[model samples]
Target: MPISQDRPFEIIVLGPPVSGKGTQAKLLAKTFDIPHVSTGQILHSIKDDIANPLAQKVAEFINAGSLVPDELVNQLVADRIKKDDCVNGFILDGYPRTLSQAQAIDTAVKLDYVFLVNVSDETIIERISGRRVCKNGHVWHIKYSPPKTETVCDDCGEPLFLRDDDKSAVVKNRLEIFHQNMAPIIEFYERAGILIRIDGEKHIEEVFQQFVRHMIYDLRNKVNRSSGGSPSGTATI
Candidate 1:
């Protein structure tokens, strides 16, 4: 576990809705020059490939508004990480929701860090509720991210509408389901001693910097311990 350059920085960033999991994951993936792999987006891309039968199957479940089965998801995930880009490591978002997938992922690769971004349920509700979007793809928030004009897209003059998923009842239900399903996955990583909890309620910049600092400190400590206090603590690009 000295994390030689031969191995990539495999990371998993997870959290409840509005916890900024994807946002932070993307930034870190860029910083590390690795792919930001999102299973949800992967499923979407697969759904668009009509000629591929397995991809079509993934599409069928999604088109029916049903949850994709874990077996298929696991297969897709396993296949995804084997691609060349992932050889340099990848930041994962929205995968391994269940213990089975978590175990499957472990068998496939050694994850460097499993970061869980935590935010209060109340803050999640507020963050989701304030989000608004227009048909033109412009998004805004009511409080901290308001548009230049009230309730209207500054570019298109289109009225912004709240997403159904952002409704209080919907968000609450989603959070409940997420935590219930993610409990075992979280426990799995914790038992492995690679899980790191992060505060997701902080400003985006603050959260990103805090995670980077913690990552560097812990990684350096691991390297030094494994190298018997040598210069392995200093990582090179």
Candidate 2:
């Protein structure tokens, strides 16, 4: 459905590290004319705002090589959702990494849907392990998307290196941490009855089709029933 004029749409997209949640969320937000609010982007947006005390605090933590604690993250999200653009609705790509953050979100905004892009652990490993990066942030997967040169980025002509975090051992540890942190948050949404599962191992277009099947097609049906819009009138283009 198109973003409603008054209420709009607020969606939360979740997935593991290599699951393409960010990619899909950006596309969906663009298709529906809404903001794609990612926590990482939010942090970066504020990091240079020296006058904001919270931004100062967040910047210090990053400069010191420390993670921004959950309380600050929650506060940032709560404040972000109240902005004027978000009044129409927005797609939240990242945030609520813990149960505490999820609870904080409960008091912050009413979400329309929470979509979990589900991919197998094996798929995650393959997707993340075959990776290479450059100083300019050009990333490539050796098997699927190799650079023109073995040791240089095609886009920037910069030397490519194996990111320490993209190494096999580090990928496994990251996946483990993901499961440990995401399990409770996933269950929290499941119990709330707004969680929808999107199979993410398929081709990108196929995965997005599945996402729209629930997010747009399903919501359209609900809107039709509630407002007397014909159920048959709302067809996927």
Candidate 3:
């Protein structure tokens, strides 16, 4: 089906930590020519902006590798989606971690689809526990660790350190807590019939391509039907 340019489409990308939601959302937004709105990235971008209290709080939590309270995060998301760039369409990542947050989002804006990237707990731990980052903002995973320099950043020669949340014990606890909070939200979306599940254990490029195909196919079908036209029943290239 062909996507009409007349109406906007909004999508929400949800997943556990280290599930690659960020990468997939960015790719889908580029493919569909829409803005990618990451609540985390948005908060990070305005970390130093003093005018917004929520931004300040979010920056503090993010810098410490902790999650922000749902109420504050919801407000930040609502504020971001009201911007001009999101008028046409938007892809959301890293928001709505709880059922309340999802309900808050429904009140703030209309969502057309929810893409859920599912990865095993073992895979998430393997991906996150081996992670390291430098003060200069470079990141590396021990399984795919940086060069022989070891503790030094290959690009800047600065020291690299393990993030507090990436420590083995912390990662385990975080994943457990995440699943506890996420189950309800997953059930909510499932009941809505707009949830599209994708396996996140695949190669990054393959996962990204699959996400793009799903978004294009779904959005085009919605547009076609909105115009009172029949579906083309063809996959997007």
Against the reference, the lDDT scores of all candidates come to 0.84, 0.83, 0.80
Candidate 3 per-residue lDDT, tens place, 112-165, comes to 778899999888888887877889899987787654566887878889888888
- Estimate, for each residue in 126-187, the C-alpha lDDT of model 2 and write its tens digit: 88878889898888988899888778899989898987877788888988999999999999
Off by over 4 Å in 2: 1-6, 133-138, 147-161, 227-237
- Give one clash count per candidate, in the order shown: 0, 0, 0
Question: Candidate 1 vs candidate 3: which has greater lDDT?
Answer: 1
User: What digit string (tens of lDDT, one per residue) describes model 1 on residues 1-237?
Assistant: 122235548889988877998899999998988889899988989887777668988978988999899889988876677688876888889988888888878877788889999999999999888888999998888887889866898778999899998898998999899989999999999999988888888989988986798778877777788788864454321
Query: How high is each candidate's TM-score?
Result: 0.85, 0.84, 0.76
Clashes of 2: 0
Off by over 4 Å in 3: 1-7, 45-47, 51-69, 132-140, 149-164, 223-237
The prediction achieving the highest lDDT against the true structure is 1
- The pairs that clash in candidate 3 are none
Better of 1 and 2 by lDDT: 1
RMSD of each: 4.3, 4.4, 5.1
State the TM-score for model 1.
0.85
